[model samples]
Target: MIKLQNVEKVYRTSSIETLALNNINLDVKKKEFISIMGPSGCGKSTLLNIMGLLDAPSKGQIEIDGSKVENYNDKDLAHLRNQKLGFIFQSFHLINDLSVIDNVEIPLLYRSSTAKQRRDLAQEALEKVGLSNRMKHFPKQLSGGQKQRVAIARAIVGKPEIILADEPTGNLDSVMGNEILGILQKLNEDGATIVMVTHDDAMAKKTHRLVRLFDGTQVM
Candidate 1:
């Protein structure tokens, strides 16, 4: 469902050129669960961002589903990203002011939908994450696990083809982290393509395949 060919990411300043990724060639098939594992500064997150269209690689081609997207303009890329990708980050990026349901409804705001429709969809998403009863709760009122569950609900509410998670369980305790992994496993079983970047070996092993990186290169 996704392909990256000879991808390279280089961050340039006036006097420094830091290469984050080098010659990354990856293909994620539909419904596959893939984990990206690497140490700090190993470019795992950079590769995930490039795949999700959040950041463009400095060189190479990207194919989503089947179309080449390397040349797509900002608006085009934005549209494609909205249509095909969902993101879950280490930190729950929920608005502290918005209620749980409201936070989950943020993605649907970009689409043409009625308030009722958004509410229903958001509610259903919360139910999937076992947060239906907390719909009215604010971020500040929830525990770490509950907050991550809220983040997961927000990511899946759009039903995107691919879920890109960057250290999704990084902030949780072992028990909570395992619970989150179980949720992700269920999503993958239900046909969502997941590409997660994690440092935990046990977590990485739970995914279908592991792609390890070192010094901006694929080492395993």
Candidate 2:
């Protein structure tokens, strides 16, 4: 469902040029769950951002569900990302002020939907993450696991075709990390294509395939 060809990313400043990715060529199939593993500064997140269309590669081509993303302007890119991609991060990027359900509803607000529809979808998403009872709770009131579950709910609220999770369980304890992996496995079984970036070997092994990286190169 996604393809990257000869992808290379470079960050340039007046005095330095850092290569974040080098010649990355990957093809992600429909409904497949893939994990990317690498040490710190290995460009895993950069690869993910490029895959999700959040950041463009300095050189190469990206094809999402067969459509080549080439020279698209900001508005066009935003629309595509909203329609096709969902993101999760290591840190729950929840608004401390918004209730859990309200946080999930944020994605739907950008779409043409009634408040009731948004509420119902948010409720259902929380249910999937086993957070239905905590709908009214704020971020500060939840445990770290609960907060990450909230982040997952927010990501899936839109039911995007692909889920790009950047270290979704990074902040949790071993037990909590395993729990989160179980949830992700369930989602994949239910037909969501997922690409997760993780530093944990056990976590990476649970996915369908593991892609290893070194420095900025795909080594395995």
Model 2 TM-score?
0.98
- Give the least accurate 10-residue stretch of model 2, judged by summed lDDT: 70-79
TM per candidate comes to: 0.98, 0.98
Residue 80: error of model 1 in Å? 1.0
Estimate the Cα RMSD of every predicted model relative to the unseen true structure.
0.7, 0.7
lDDT of 2 at 95: 99
Model 2, C-alpha of 79: deviation from truth (Å): 1.0
The sequence of per-residue lDDT tens digits that candidate 1 reaches over residues 1-220 is 9999999999999999999999999999999999999889989889999999989999999999897996799999988888888999999899999999999999999989999999999998898889999999999999999999999999999889899999999999999999999999998998999999998999998899999999999988
* TM match of model 1 to true structure: 0.98
* Per-residue lDDT over 72-153 for candidate 2, one digit per residue giving the tens place of the 0 to 100 score: 8888888888888889999989999899999999989888999999999999999999999999999999999999999999
